[model samples]
Target: MTADENWWNGSVTYQIYPRSFQDDTGNGYGDLKGIIRRLDHVAGLGVDAIWVSPFFTSPMADMGYDVADHRGVDPSFGTMADFEALVTRAHALGLKVIIDQVLSHSSDTHPFFLESRSSRQNSKADWYVWADAKPEGSPPNNWQSIFGGPAWTWDVRRRQYYYHQFLKEQPDLNFHNPEVQDWALDTLRFWLDKGVDGFRLDAVNHYVHDAGLRDNPPDFRDKTEPDYKTYEMQYPVHSKNQPENLAFMERVRALTDSYPARTLIGEIGESHYPVERLQEYTAPGRLHQAYHTALMHKPYGAAFFCKQIEAMFRDAYAGCPNWAFSSHDVPRHVSRWSDHAVTQDDFAKMTAALLLSLRGSICLYQGEELGLGQSALSYDQLVDPEGKTFWPDNPGRDGCRTPMPWEAQAPNAGFSSAADTWLPVLPPEAARAVDTQGDAESVLTFYKQMIGLRQDQPALRAGDLVFLDMSEPVLGFVRGGEILCLFNLGLTEAVIDTANVGDTLLSRFADVQDEQITLGGNGFLIARRLSE
Candidate 1:
């Protein structure tokens, strides 16, 4: 099992939202010790790596995303020793550890920001994105935060506005300053020296914004999305996905390349031209891989999926993609795509198989393996600021970020020893706890099986994809030139003639008889093509 220069090739990286993974201290909050306690569970899934979300020292403005100190672990999550232990234990289990690095922004409480805001003549005054307000005291530009407000926040001391692409507490860093870039690189070095295998760079596309401070063009697209945020009303051309980000990525890549087999996976959150940015950012000498929010947000269907995948491969031929159907920020895929499947469990298994069959690396969100659907939380139970702002109409991400259910009958579903959790665990999620499905022919087992198949099959792991002509509802593609992967995204049965398609390798809720394949509702199949 030797790895090449690109060890992440054809691998599965399980994403663990540290706050909800496990709470080992009975503090009602997940910590490093909890993740260490659950390493075996993750290893059992046969994933190649684990991507732990930020556990950095922070003010918790946006959970752990708003870091107050880049190099220190948050006291709530654990100390530096605990993080070291986690890395050591993960390495012992043959799992590479990829920690989330939120380089785009930091909490306003961060030391640099504090100093920068104190006075205009301070040494670090320009460390963060600061601009003067227009004559009318309006924001410098028409940029909007992803969290539904103006991107600029007024600061009394400096009498200037600081930009934040999220909550005002999270001030965006000024990549235009060479000193800031150097400092950011040094921060990456600190983690790399700590024996981390890689980093999932948060909001990599947002690293650089238009230096000229131009207004973003309006987004006139029809608003059909149920949970549409006001931020989506603008094109965000000048706010993010700037060309300067590519050079900065190259700098990031140069640093990671110095470490043996270390990788960098950038998260590109651009609503429009995300794939284009992903392709540019992940090209050779840039980040090793790039993941966009397309899969997590798009409507479920063969056509939509096929179009996304094909566009990614076509545009980013030289780059690698890290595909994921769910994450801490988005609703769980099983629930998000519920209308497209027959049953939750059935859809989970089918999507698992389909995700594993795709080319490039994959990221399995923490609870997806247990077929966990979104936990419906009330407005009062919501902790995500985005959810709170759009409550009733748009429930926030707390539903997806709820604690991981470990025990079906235990207190707080065994997520915490405390009577209450940060977010309530709904009964539906508790019922599908890991203990109940550990041995059964459940979604967890199916994920393990599919992942094992991916690990054993070279074609499925590192294959070049070639789409086959198939009608609506059925997606057919050849991987590595020999493996035929087909999926039925419709609710009804779909049949495809397999007169020339080869040996059946794996099937989920589907059957093949007399050279014809019949995929039941939400079914899928993977086969090896017959050699000429």
Candidate 2:
């Protein structure tokens, strides 16, 4: 790929939720040294880049998402020297390193927030989003958090309500404040200077809020949504996806422009504005790629995939969008879509192949290739505060945060030598251990081969998506006007009416033929366009 060309296209991004990836010191949590030790395993997966979740200094309230020190590593993860070694090792293994940047907020223990909350006259008083309580003391507005309940929290010292879109301990950063923006940008440069390749901007759109502090409008449409955020029935018009955030994104773009071949990807989430904001964030001088929750859920079927990819292509946003069937925030795809027509193993392999064949880039959450299902955690075993609050209604994301299984027989799945791990690894996942799945016919092996195909095939890499409309359960598209992709999301057999296109290049099951293509249940077809 050219220097200016986007490297993220068709690239496989491996997401390592550091806390659960591996534990080096047996401290009951995975750390930086553990990641460094496993760099070879990651590189062996044929992924183009590795995206490490936050390891920034924090109180562990939100598992390091609440940053106390932006430039330093948490003692639990490792020291700065260990981080440097990780970057060096990852790069040496031909893997790009992208760290998570939690620019949206910081822990209450953060110096800026501590000073900001002390009094209104402090040097950093405006560093966080703070507002006086209403006369009725109900709250600034009806902004419920994803974790549940009101997004605003009371502060006894300041006697004012402060904003936190997430956990109250994670106070929202005042991106509206010029100093705050400058400080965040400087922090970005600090890691860039450390030889980091890129950043996965956490809740990037949530950085800025409505200066007016107006209440979010009601939305009774999605009242059936299991969570409080959706049940509050409010459209977060002024609260998130603020018009002002785009200009700041341009500033971030300018800062990253100085670094050669570096990338910036934002995690765009807003109930009202999704794909449109994705386009705005990545249009030219903003983010290199923007990911949404479009293909991140739902069954691995034809209609859902077709509608999503086709919509992106029709909107012309497919060029810079990133797709993942599963991530840390959601249940594993194997478990989520296991209800569809196939076994868990088939669901996992099919999703992996489909993700690699998509027009845009892809992110592979850790252990996804092994067909790891969501870990079953009882209410008592749930360590995630988010999960605890929602209880049985909204189980939160604890299921996907379980430790990775490396061994089939070792206790704790060999994730840690420690007597216990942060989260238990289930027996089924243990059976799909890396050691057992390293062989040629294993699911892991298939992922390796498919990822290699994506990297090596130009048509799959920088391809323009061409929609091939078909009946339900059959999703079809052309990559680079050369590679034809078809997916059967339903149970029964499906046909690829290749009357216009010719012969199958690849098939999930069955052999290639000269003319039409027939696929069995949960089958897929890939073909090279005939010379025209």
Candidate 3:
């Protein structure tokens, strides 16, 4: 098959949260040059590509997720030349680069938004979603922001309320306007022309809201749940996730297809019928792949994995999934699932195996290979707006967004020369730094072996996934009818007969007898089928 056809079908991508990944200037923030210096380490991991979070020109209100200029590199990240060199270095190391594209909204300071809000009849007027308030000066609708409170912010310049799905500083663009659609496409072309392999489209569902200015109905599901987010109190069918996204995605796909081997992946933040939305967005002519937060949530069990995996493959029309255990926006899986493990390293190794063995593509967050857990930060040290807004009860994602620890005893864990980081580099994280985990039994070593095994065994990559019948705490599956994978995900030992399975190809904490296979807690086995 040609490389362009489906290079990401079962590929593995390493995600780099640029600000906390590596700092080269001793400025307490990571930049493009720091990432360039670390390219060799990423290439050594046997990953297919790297997906970087935003580094575009931004005010950092949302830490680069809010873009002020779509086409320019932020000075905090480095000059435009630094980005060009980064792409050059990544390609030389055999690593494809995928950058974050925040297309749904732009910073309020953006010139386009400034012009759009400037009197109703300016040349750039109608560039953003603008609506007049009610007679009593109330918001146009009951739609809420994901960050907090009302989704509408009043702007006196045009005597209208502008829409922001996230922070008020970020104004949603009017995709219903063809001109805005063209501008978004042009922003994407700006990067494709710079040699990027793909883009991780941010907030793909929030692109076009209902043009009718409808009020969202109350959501009955989450009102009873503890610590339920205020925004999710109402069903957002009309507020966002409009059917219009499907056609807009096709336009994005068409532009991406113009370049060789380019890809487009979308992030669906929908809570209602999420998997279906993921599939709808990634249909043949749209996004190449799309991911939802199903796996990233707190649910952990064989049944949960079985059901979620089955949902993705059951519908042939829904495009394939790219699975992740942790990311910049969520808590680290090790810390999140600590109840299931006897040791953090064992759980980390087991989760890594499970994620890699899945049917679709994989994305590994930085420091995952080293078994890094989420860092706990004091309220005073919080950097995430989400975390600060929701203190105590929900400490936000700052815990998971800590700096990458590269060395154990070196200054700031060899991540930066500065004494402090934008987010503190906690000691627990520094203890498991890459330098300290090179032992034969380290999680890092196991990750390399697992990634190599997946690359070596085609059945693990593109093979069809047929789940075997197993009860709770024990999961088994066959790939391409040749490779059988078994896992014991409990806190105690389990023994099962595996006489039908052939020689073991890989295992951890597993012992095989004549017919019975003994699996210790968090144990796993990958064997070739005897009949194959």
Prediction 3 global C-alpha lDDT: 0.89
Q: Which one wins on TM-score?
A: 3
* TM-score, one value per model: 0.97, 0.96, 0.98
Residue 142 error for model 1, in Å? 1.2
Which run of 10 residues does model 3 get worst, by summed lDDT?
Answer: 220-229
Question: Which tens-of-lDDT digit does each residue in 131-244 have in candidate 1?
Answer: 998999988988998898788989999999999999999999999999989999999999999999999999898988899999989895666664467688899888887788
Q: Which 10 successive residues of model 1 have the least lDDT summed?
A: 220-229
- Prediction RMSDs, each to the true structure: 1.6, 1.9, 1.4
Clash list (residue pairs), candidate 3: none
Quantify all predictions' global Cα lDDT against the true fold. 0.89, 0.82, 0.89
Positional deviation of residue 462's Cα in model 2 after best superposition, in angstroms: 0.7
lDDT for each residue of candidate 2 in 312-351, tens digit (9 for 90 to 100): 6565453477788788899888788777747776667777
The better-scoring model by TM-score among 2 and 3 is 3
* Residue 174 of model 1, lDDT score: 95
In angstroms, the error of model 2 at 228 is 4.1
